[model samples]
Target: MQAVLNAISDPTRRAALALLQGGEECCVCELMTRLNASQSRMSRHMKMLQDAGLVIGRRDAKWVRYRRNRDLAPEFAAVIDAVLAAERPLEEDMA
Candidate 1:
């Protein structure tokens, strides 16, 4: 739970989660482009999210495709849902 909290504490990671919340798999490049982040930075963020079990990544040829972990524990999922809901206004403002 601490790891999950730590992971979502970053705005970048939260934005990434928002993107993945739709259930579509997104490539690292897509995330980088959408977030206006560099490759290395986005990679690190994705690594943290993966380590926290908030997301899963698959090697898609030369890139990694990521999506939210549908298998999350109910507690963790609830936490994510709440955070995303709270962050929605900020997300909309950014968009």
Candidate 2:
């Protein structure tokens, strides 16, 4: 519960998760663009999510793409799904 709460506490992290909900893995550059944040800022939020076991990142040819860490915690998945479902106008995903 604490992990899930902490993971969603930051709007940046929530936006990152929202972007990832589109079913496409996102590279750091893409996230930096989409989130309109500095590389360091994005990386820092990503690290928080990674530490929370909410996201997984993998390197590919100099790019690091991130996606929801499905294998780490099923409970976290349910929590994310529920929150997203209850939230209206899931529009931040486009940004």
Candidate 3:
């Protein structure tokens, strides 16, 4: 889907997806810390992922935790899997 393409187009968002694909909900603050991003920056990135249906966030007390939407269409799911498998090298370089 076009939304899936748009969602994974950003390196940061793809990294976020990599984290979320691990099957645990991650806090927005934690994502910002890992990404070295400001709160607003993380929020904006997350909003894009959310709109694309690649992720979903829920209020958890003061923080919103996000995780990948396993309900994604099969085509999109395949893309997420590909990103996870293919982008590890890039993540290591970023580190």
Candidate 4:
């Protein structure tokens, strides 16, 4: 799917999604630290995730938290899940 491809096209976005898959909704600050990405760059990636309907972000005062869109396309989610599953390094790094 175009949306799925777009969402995972960037390593940054993939890393973000991979991180999100592990946590209970995370804020921008947390994501920045985990991904070691600049604010602007992370924001752009978040925008793409939102546009793809793969993630949903909500504002909480100064924090903007993001989580996977549970209702998103199953096929797309499956693809991301598969990739994230295959990247054992990503999982190990999270621990």
Top lDDT: which candidate number?
1
Q: What is candidate 4's lDDT per residue for 33-89, written digit by digit as tens?
A: 889998888998998998889889999998889998889777777888888788867
> What stretches of model 1 exceed 4 Å from their correct place?
93-95
Model 4 spans with C-alpha error above 4 angstroms: 89-95
TM-scores, one per candidate: 0.94, 0.83, 0.89, 0.85
Global Cα RMSD, each model? 1.3, 2.9, 1.6, 2.7
Clashing pairs in 1: none
Please list the residue runs of candidate 3 whose C-alpha ends up more than 4 Å from where it truly belongs after superposition.
93-95
Please write out the lDDT profile of model 2 over residues 1-95, one tens digit for every residue.
Answer: 78778988877888898888867799878999998999999998998888888888999998888998868567778888777666535554645
- The CA lDDT at 9 in model 1 is 94
Which order, best to worst by lDDT?
A: 1, 3, 4, 2
- Candidate 1 per-residue C-alpha lDDT over 20-40 given as tens digits, one digit per residue, 9 for 90 to 100: 998989998999999999999
lDDT of 2 at 71: 82
Candidate 3 Cα lDDT to native: 0.88
Evaluate model 3: give its TM-score: 0.89
- Give the alpha-carbon lDDT of every model: 0.95, 0.83, 0.88, 0.85
lDDT for model 2: 0.83
Model 2: runs farther than 4 Å from truth? 90-95
